[model samples]
Target chain A: MSGHSYDAEKYWKANLRLIFGSLIVWALVSYGFGIVLRPMLSGIPIGGTDLGFWFAQQGSILTFIALIFHYAWRMNRLDKQFGVDEE
Target chain B: MSQFAINIMFVGGSFLIYILIAVWAKAGSTKDFYVAGGGVHPITNGMAIGADWMSAASFISMAGIIAASGYASSAYLMGWTGGYVLLAMLLAPYLRKFGKFTVPEFIGDRFYSKQARLVAVICLIVASLTYVIGQMAGAGVAFSRFLEVDSTMGLIIAAVVIFIYSVLGGMKGITYTQVAQYCVLILAYTIPAVFISLQLTGNPIPALGLFSTHLDSGMPILDKLNQVITDVGFSEYSADVDSHLNMVLFTLTLMIGTAGLPHVIIRFFTVPKVADARWSAGWALVFIALLYLTAPAVASMARLNLMTTVYPDGTAAEPIRYEDRPQWVKEWEVTGLIKYVDKNEDGRIQMYNDASDEPGTAFQAEAEARGWKGNELDVNRDIIVLANPEIANLPGWVIGLIAAGGLAAALSTAAGLLLAISSAISHDLIKGSINPGITDRGELLAARISMAVAIVVATYLGANPPGFAAQVVALAFGIAAASLFPALMMGIFSKRINNIGAIAGMLSGLVFTLSYIFVYKGWFFIPGTANLADTPANWVLGISPLSIGAIGALVNFAVAFVVANATDEPPVEIQELVESVRYPRGAGQAQDH
Candidate 1:
């Protein structure tokens, strides 16, 4: 029982860490690049406007797609490593 | 065939497909009704979610708002899509592991309090119902404009069709129908965009075309747009907004609100497994991004097109004569969404920014130099998407297709919202509380009845459509963001949050958000009753009522944490449930009779 509990704790901690990291990237891309630092990054042009405009309008959404798929893949691997994967 | 016939064929054909899907996938039992028998594939579920989540606003109005507002309106795109990321990571998988039929069921069980569940149910119902009214009204507009029907008649037709499929097959029917709807709407959206993009930039992909040099002008589309609009006295198209605080908070409000919306959350419950829930959210975004990516292209291109249309040679040249307005304008003029008046009585349309108080005073010099009066065109923002293909002079078939697509977007979301509303009433309010011992058959009957009732109410409200229908949607998002989202997130993450704490958090969040909105938007959105005027001057630190949900969410979290520390922890069994949900190891198919 103790060993099982330990493994569960480890798995949960790993999950939390992954979520925290992904959320950072999420916040950074949308709020950071898209809104807060848009002016600073205006020097870097994408299509017509600056990189920040692209991120706000197009880039953040594409990154969100990649992030979800990446999280699903990474989490599923973590689940198996912890023997927590649903049979 | 006439354009009207083509429009009818397109719309009627889509209706036929929906009815057929309803017959084929008709719900047989309570499980089928609630969560589509829990057998949906990840990709299929994703497409359904795309259709279900986009709503009329996303399809018909969002691009218009973006076209008009430019970079600031990117919040709609980022906020709406970013919510899926939160859902995949924080909510969907855990909820799937818990294996509930409805969102409130999880809340009810997790907090071990009927009161907590009831609060969630109320929030879910209010949000979903308010949101559905917008869809109904949007569908009515689409019908009136395209099919040449009265808007009220259109609402009833839409209602009858929703009743047929949703009542017959419930979520099962809705899921399949939405897949078809997604295809229709996406094609309708992108085809015109592709044509316009090719026209403007020689780029096939609209997303790429936005950045590419315009073939005609030999300059990037955005640069040209910025130059022209500013030349005519509009702000830079891609200029950074004035207040970072409001933008961040507004975008965050939309993100959390999207994640918390009951209709969207319940779509996850339809997928078979926890992992599928995660993958499904990704797939849904993939399908949605097809339209979303095209939308900005559509917006910028449409804005540029409108500008060039009015100013034939350029802003320096003579504007088009009122009598020589294009066929599209003439047609839209009939709908009254687009009106042309020679404000200067010069017989030529002089469309330029006329608002003296707004930021773009540069237009004043241009206007005075050109001998222009106030802007000649009163163009409603909602006409952008509807008028895009016409603006680009795309073939008539594309126009017909867009009509179908608009209806599909509206109907698919309406069905999804109706299902969420009905399930909350029947599953949580009735089966879970009022009569736990009711038979599965009885519950299914109740679900159908409630769905029918919800549709009737939505259609009636849509037809009458109070002056504040649009504002009510902001209320819906506020309720979900402040109340349901915080409660659900806390319930999953913390076993220490007891019923009392959860209840307190929900009530405080809901009340704070609602009162903030009501205080500015008028108590309950009644016009002129506002304690404080709904303007930037009266706002709390310049945070609009529309963006207050983010602060309301913070209040929920702070209050819940403080209250939970002061009170006892949740029960041992509830803690065990949390532990079980965390692992996702034993999540079988959602429990069914």
Candidate 2:
């Protein structure tokens, strides 16, 4: 029980920070690069289309998979750190 | 062997496997029925989630939608899969820690209000029922095609298959069955794509094949598709969307709605731990991505193949004579999905966009010079995927595999949705409220009965589909986004949201979304009774009704905070519950009364 609250608060803060960062990449790939900023990035071609178009169809899905796995890996580490992991 | 025998062998063989699994894993208790004994491995559960999440729409119709609409349809691909990121990060782990059987049970307990639970149930039922009707209809189509039965008989056949395994094994049965289904559907979806990709781009991997150079044209496959489609007077394959705001909002609605849906969320419950739940969501996306990544390749490749078939000699030159069309066209023609009429008294099939009003008048002028009166070839979008094997001239076994695969996609999702609906009735409504003291045996019986009832209702609706059956997918996602998702999120993340506040938020979201959709689609989607047209000019802020759910969610959050701040905070115990759920500690098998 030593430093339990302190560790929990720290763990949550870290988790939230990780989540916040993940979401930024999430939004950047899907909504930002995929939709809104598409025209600006239209000059950079990929697979016969612009980077934005790739992000919209293919890149966003691939990025989303990475984001989820990354969150899972990081959160599992956080769980161990905070001693909140189920044994 | 004939094609009919091969299809039956595949479909019948798959059905036997499902029934054997269901019999082997029959549910002995409500716990097994509800959460599959709450000991499912994350990867196993993830495969089931893949099967559950990818419905008939994803398997059969989505590629067709992408093939038709091109870049604008990316919203469906990205929006659907992107929600898993939200699910893994925002919802799944905590809900698993909360240790509940049904979604509304969590809502009811977290909010400390029966009203909140009931609202959650309503949202789950409405959204799930609407979604399942489409699946039933889709299964019917697949059945009629392969079984040579009318769609009504096909619907009944689908319902019986769903009832057998879902009622027998419950989640345990469905979980294993869905793993089988995932394999079948993925093979069904990707094999034809692989063959077609190899044919077009010399790449067996469909996702990469999409970007590789077309072997015949010596240009990137997408570039070749764009040129081919534009030559036929269609818009550029990668054209920018007309309304970016609507696209953003539409994608947002699908994401949040995907996160909120009861069927998808419930799959996480079957996992053993909070950490497993998180990993399971990631695994689910991995399986789903296998199909999703190939879908664009399938869509673009199928479209190019279709265009080339029609204009055998370029569109500038003469098209092939109608009588000289390929075997695939004639095969599809018997199904009435493809039709060709001799326009301008020409024997050749002059298939091009003949619309004079569009900006591209160049194709129209060429058509006029070629003495074409109208677009003579009418191809249904649904045929793009269904006829893909034939289009690629694959063997009979592949076509049979596709038959079984389509049914697997439809049946797997239908069972998942039916489970969600039945559990809401048996566990949440019956045991939680109507008969709180009901014995475990009695509740299990009730669960089975409701599962049977739900299947009957689903089949009936699927057989005699409403005119707007196709349009209700947006409604399903809209309600889920507006009502259940916000309420669940607030219940977990906001300790200050009292019962009154949670109830207010749910009602506001439900009413706002429902009214917006009803105003455009008519009350209950009764045709010709809408207050205003569903066109873009009459839209609020140019946001279509499909995109209004994102705004509705904002309304929910805003209303929830205002009401919560004005009123009282949630009780101390509930606040502590939120704290406990936030961590991964002490999650055991889901508790049964």
Candidate 3:
């Protein structure tokens, strides 16, 4: 494999993919379940109240951890694709 | 031991640990002083940074701030952590690749101008100083609260502890000590939270307990809280208060600011490789999570605890007779953080948000029913975390542990900030500019002296302290966000960004952001000097002073880009430097030069 010669476009595209996907989830857990979609999620009770409150307090934070990990994993793969992966 | 003696013993034990760590890991030479010999493990470095980043505000007050204000407060949670992500991605790895001793060194070398380095130095000092003062203040508050002492005495103790370790250890010493501090703090924070969670929700983990059913209420505790709180004319306990636009901007600003914080970013320089820097950030967050996750639970449970204690029958009647209030309530009341007045000459407590004039409103009704004048309880939000365990009637050890944790948070961050400031002074100010021909020994001596000066300043400021923990944290975040972040980003990302552009942008952002806060907050929050009333409603564009840095950052980018496009591109060698910084090629062994 060529050193520092893999596709820049692919790298850019991969970053975009990760960003948008993780952002969508971030928005969903935080905004969707937390506020905007809170009433909609009120039907599915977490313990007693709807899922929205959980999303606000605990869900958003948990999702952030997952999001960062997902990004790290995807970006590592992208790094390998671009031949920028450190030995 | 008396509860006060127990508090002193626990706090004394923590200081002993920090001092021991400092002595064992104290810097041996200039190399050891600057970057911890670049030998730190990713995990250890992460904990060090977590301690370094959490500060007294995060450990003691953040959750209460969030619980009290509702949605507008989510910014602190999302933004502060989000900044770490930005740090990992945009700044840390690249900066580590540059392999510098100080942030100003990066600016000077990248921009190839002493003026640019000077600009970075000024910003670093201002941001670090403002932030360190807050930590000092936090340390003082922590000492005062648990030690049964006045805050001024607490400030002096915090300062002395910081001076001993920070002046002795430098960065190398500070790093190892921070690791210990991180442990002490996390344990201190979690113990009480666990006990409270178990009591309230039958869950051991407070984070999980937040969503669990309340054993007492026969429902999810939050629902019960909302029901009871709103019945007394309070907004639903779980309701959101901030608009989406403000929340997003506020979070973004904090993220950007956190990423930009000179002290936290400098922690990455302690590790060996670019990969270590990346992993170090993840680790730091993990350590931070140990406390962060527990904080909200502590907050929610604490709020619930306070309410229940105040209103056993869920109203003003027989409100825990003033003389019969819990030991914790009596203890905190003396701090002036909690106040009670038998205004009606009644022996009962009537705590309600009676600000609403609408007679039919729940709060007004509760007040009228109870013969209360207004929201009688004036509990300071900062006390929520510190007083939670005691409030719940948990064992003495848990309360003692919290005292240790709050001190750890303040000390670790203070040490980190001081190191950043001192390194900038010794490396950039003296060696780089004041006396380029200074010997290695001289540089080392200068570094030590500078560290001493930084500690003295931090100690002095902390001793006096600006009084508010979260507010001070916001100011720290605002300055860091406004100035350092933009300069660092442009330095690495834009090769064509000339020294002029970098300096101009930094100065512009710094002056704009600081002056904006000052216009409303008065010069240094010295009351009677504020030209405009200081509140969210009076802010320009409805942006809180906390959010001004985000706007300032935009100005920085705009000024930088326009200037860069107009100027000639950076020299070929500079471009090479940029490319090398981008990829970690041949950055295998970070030399101890």
Give candidate 2 regions above 4 Å deviation: A1-4
lDDT of 3 by residue, B285-348 (tens): 7677777777777877888887888888775345667877888888888778889877777777
Q: Pick the candidate with the highest DockQ.
A: 1
Per-residue lDDT of candidate 1, residues B444-505 (tens digit): 99999999999998999999877567785478778889999999999999989999999999
Please give the lDDT score at residue B230 for candidate 2.
87
Candidate 3, residues A1-87, lDDT tens digits: the string is 222344654564566566677677776776567666776777787765568767766667677766666566666666676666667
- Judged by lDDT against the true structure, how good is candidate 1? 0.91
State how far residue B564 of model 2 sits from its true place (Å).
0.5
Q: What share of the true interface contacts does each candidate keep?
A: 0.85, 0.75, 0.18
CA lDDT, candidate 2, residue B94: 92
Flag clash pairs in model 1: A47-B211
Candidate 2 Cα lDDT to native: 0.91
Compared with the real two-chain complex, what DockQ does model 2 have? 0.68
Pick by lDDT: 2 or 3, better one:
2
Question: In candidate 2 chain B, where is summed lDDT lowest over 10 consecutive residues?
Answer: B465-474
